[model samples]
Target: MGDGLPDLPPLFGPVFALREGGDALARAVALAPEHGAGCFVWVRAYARVEAAVVLEPEQPLAAARPALLAAAAAMADALAALGPPQAEIALRWPATLVVNRGVVGAARLAAPPGAAETAVPAWLAVGVEVRRALPPGVEPGTDPGRTALEEEGFDEADTAELTAAWARHLMTGLNEWQERGFARLAGRYLGWLERDPAQAGAARRGLDSATGDLVLQRPDGALTRRSLRAAVAEGVA
Candidate 1:
């Protein structure tokens, strides 16, 4: 916590910090192989909260992938704690995160090499970036479609504190998944997930426990699925 650096918990492995221009996600992925589980890497940037965590799962990739949802849920929890009381935050299925209707952050996942849906991955790296503040001279609400923590009334949202909060929440979410069940984790995620107001009664969304896919159920019982594995392949979470 000194000098406002991220203070990671004891359960985590080695933690690395990158300069403003470095990519936290890429570096974390690179470290995942050698550092193994619980390795954390982050960029101490001026305008965003950027970080990633390495994990080794006991379950197969399919089952382990729900960790992405846990990460997303963790982000929402982390923000809520530091943002204005009762501030609005939502998860856009798969990866995107919204703050007061503007895209503020996102999470991405990386599966280990040679990983298959049924295989237990050697490691997985989950990276997240949140707009902490705009560069000096940038005006808030200049673009309604994008936002940052400072612009959203999160006066107490220090980058280091927020990052530490996220890591703690992520660990708690995963532990709940392992001990209580995926249902436990899914509930927290779904609670923060965004829904189409126009199609309120026309569709429903649920997560497939085994594959971590998003299932959109139509009123007529027709279902559309979004693959978590596919998102990992496409380089997003």
Candidate 2:
């Protein structure tokens, strides 16, 4: 499949393709310990655009939150590059992409549970899937919030092109994350967050000093940390 397609972009040079389809997550996790870092796996024939990146673990997986956030920010950057206007695209907190107010796709990250963050991880995988085409016979307004690129008039974007663009953006994000800090990444991500009623009456939108979690400070001076982990687990912001 990908053989007949055009070449992948330069940034994704380390990609490896799988011949059989069993479990991409298992495959990625199994291979991560060997290749170490920057190893990627891509499956083109599948229904989704899937890939993974490897990272060494230094501390426990829970402590790896900042790195996970960095990877997520990287994915958001990748999606933004394909837009008609750069930075106009953004991700809803907890892993949803809202492009021009429409859902383009989603990104998922994985690693061994209880793995260390500061130490080289056994392996880390970040997979992204974009709906290039809609299920046949599906009509608009049937699902107002759900959409594919084809439905939104992005006919020019093939899977390969999107994959390449994502790879480039991801690398840029990771580099920036390592060089600068999460402050910039967090700022970019915060700009794209969709407003929710749960955050009304807060001193600020969602700023928390403790563990960098989003918090709501009421007029009564009560501060509660908005559980981003729970939000991510439920796939909502």
Candidate closest to the true structure, highest TM-score: 1
Can you give the lDDT of residue 159 in candidate 2? 64
Model 1 clashing-pair count: 0
Tens digit of lDDT per residue, candidate 2, span 64-136?
Answer: 4444455555556655555445334656656676656777666666766775434445656766666666677
Q: What is the C-alpha RMSD of each candidate to the true structure, in Å?
A: 2.2, 3.9
Q: What TM-score should be assigned to candidate 2?
A: 0.76
Which stretches in model 1 have alpha-carbon errors above 4 Å?
A: 1-6, 197-200
Distance from true position, residue 101, model 2, in Å?
A: 3.6
Tell me the spans in candidate 2 whose CA falls farther than 4 Å from its real position: 1-13, 18-26, 45-47, 57-60, 85-88, 116-120, 201-212, 216-222, 231-237
Residue 50, candidate 1: how far off, in angstroms?
Answer: 0.8
lDDT for each residue of candidate 1 in 1-237, tens digit (9 for 90 to 100): 123566677778688888888887788889887888989887777788988899999999999988888888999999988789857999887778899999898988878677887888898888788988887887887888998888888887677888889999999998899899989988899889888553366467788999998788889998878788787677665
